[model samples]
Target: MDASIFSAPKIDCHCHIFDPESFPYAPGVFYAPSGGEIATADYFMQVMSAYGVSHALLVGPNSGYGTDNRCMLDAIRRGGHRFKGIAVVENDASASQLQDLQAQGVVGIAFNMALLGLAHYANADALWERIAALDMCVQVQVQDDQMAELAPRLLGCGAQIVVDHHGRPDISRGLASPGFDALLRMADSGRCAVKLSGYDKFSREALPFADAQPFTDVLLSAFGPANCLWGSDWPNIRATRRLDYGTLLGVFERSVPSEADRRTILVDTPMRLFGFGTGGN
Candidate 1:
């Protein structure tokens, strides 16, 4: 294996920490992360260290802890500034509650429509307003053509939209698909960003998804290098294929071949987007 990827400082824009032992799974949860899916904050830091990842944006998982951000809050507290977060909140979350999470290092809110359908957030206009008012972003994970419906409302509210998983495009439909096209149009908004991640989420093929390169190309062109972020959806929960931290770094390397572009995606962009200091945890 090549050891060069570890030589640079990198921030994982998206990852998770599930500690069912320290914090038991909440009741009425969608799914519990037993066995291989379980990953404590301590374990994730160790993994980051091993793979040359300096910091991470810890996204609060919807499963096993819906609207209860305590587990994620705990991880940010213990992470010692090495982690920032995107929290999941109830539709009617108050400003004070958002301030509480922001004070603790949460920079955004996660609206994972890919897991919870679009209709679940139909009445979220107020939520968007709150997130924008607090200077936080809406980190959205929508599949296929969903972006078309969500983009106008998101931009209309003046909330920064941080899209997840390369817009989770329908690969068979090609790049001009409604959702991805709408995503590209967002480039002009100066308020949208897409993660150069989650190849396994949409790709019909395997890891190191060559099938997704064309889409990646247009996204970079649309959003530009600065607006694009990279994330490792670590622990591979609810994922069909195996995912490794190191392997993902390599995939990123291949995806953006330019050294300057890679530097921006791996370090500069995230450091600017989230508030991560240099050096590993």
Candidate 2:
């Protein structure tokens, strides 16, 4: 039996990179970019090669770069076939600008509503329409407090929605919590997908990542294998050193504990979500 044939095709659905030494941070933003001087796309490729990840989604980081996607675009271009990107756009970006981004292999747009607040994009309907016509997805990072207030409107905007950071659910509130339940409802409608990343963000513990499993269980059950995707959340920000991409991957192995489940989470699903396949390439 060939090991390559049996080996899982990993697709990382979330990650961020920036060259702090070259790119100046956008001023006046509360959310700072992840530390590490210039962790380039080449670095990520080496890590992926070590882990058997063949493809990845390069999520543009919110390091106060504003709408200047130059660094991210360069990273994706250099990453070649191994990477795709999701970008940040001004609420009023013109259709031509969006079309240009799509041409550059950007498949989605991410909004950090938790930190930026919903009111900023009050006039984003036109941009949303353009995205819908282009068939792009929208990645939203909203914690539980804002999920009730913002998720429905975001979902109603007529584009595929990717919920970030384990749907930003409150673990202490349990599985049936409104935020997690809302995510389930979105998955039920078949228009939403969730990233099984960022265990350190929600859990209070130092290790094992057991505290984050309930949220993962709900996502797995609600979205089934197809609508779920996994991310390394490399160089984890808030909890920083407690977990690296490798540590997260290990926790996933222990928690999921099934090759079939892992395959869907790691491979099949992300390809489908990111439009990487149609008749096996």
Candidate 3:
């Protein structure tokens, strides 16, 4: 694999870490952490330095940690301006709470709807207004089947939105998938962006991640270089085998070969989205 890809000052836009024992997931919450030795801020920083990633956008995981972004926030604080966080708070968070989270380094808020089920955010529009007022991006995880119904509401929010895991599209249906088609159209309208990640969960086959290529290619063409970002979906839960981040980056190289495009997905796009190079620049 190419170690050069891990060159310095890289930005990783999506990652999660939590101590399951302390956080204690709530019942009825749709997703659970696939147990692994807990990964902490120090561990993340060590890994980031090893990968030469200087900045990261810490997305809160749906592991029942709910609204308690303490560990992640602490990590950002200690990372010393090298990090930003996307908090996971209840949709009904008070105005002051949102403002305080912003002060704590939260740049966005995420709704893990794809993993938790869309019905949970039936009031997404209302929630969007609060986050939008904060000038924070809204991240939603929607599977391909849910796109047609969800995209319209997402667009109506009139706020910047990020769709995770290749729009959670169903590759077996190919281009005919209405959900995927809708996402492509949304990307074209310049209203949204997507992450090329979590292929292990979406893919039908095993290693080398060949099953995920077609979907990744479609995203490249639809979102173009500027709107696409790549993520390792590190410490992936669905896998029976332990997959390393280096291998995931290697998978990206094979799937999207254009150096220019790779730079956009891995470097340029995230830099812009996360506002890299601020005085922190």
Clashes of each: 0, 1, 2
Candidate 1, residues 148-241, lDDT tens digits: the string is 8888888888888899999999999999899999999999998888999998899998878999999999999999999999999988788888
- Per-residue lDDT for 18-124 in model 2, tens only? 66556666777555555553566778788888877787888877764767787778887787667788999888887789889989989998888766777876777
Which candidate, 1 or 2, has the higher lDDT?
1
lDDT of 3 by residue, 1-281 (tens): 33356562356777877656555565665556645646667777788778777677888777646667886787788887878888888877876888998898888889877766778888667878887787788888888688888888888886788888888777688776998888888886685889888776677777676877888888888889799887776556556666787777778778888776777777788777767653354
Provide TM-scores for the models: 0.96, 0.90, 0.90
Worst 10 residues of 3 by lDDT: 1-10
Q: Which pairs clash inside model 3?
A: 277-281, 278-281
lDDT of 1 at 164: 96
lDDT per model vs. reference: 0.88, 0.76, 0.76
What's model 3's lDDT at 16?
78
Best by lDDT: 1
Model 2 TM-score? 0.90
In model 1, the runs with Cα more than 4 Å from the true position are 1-3, 279-281
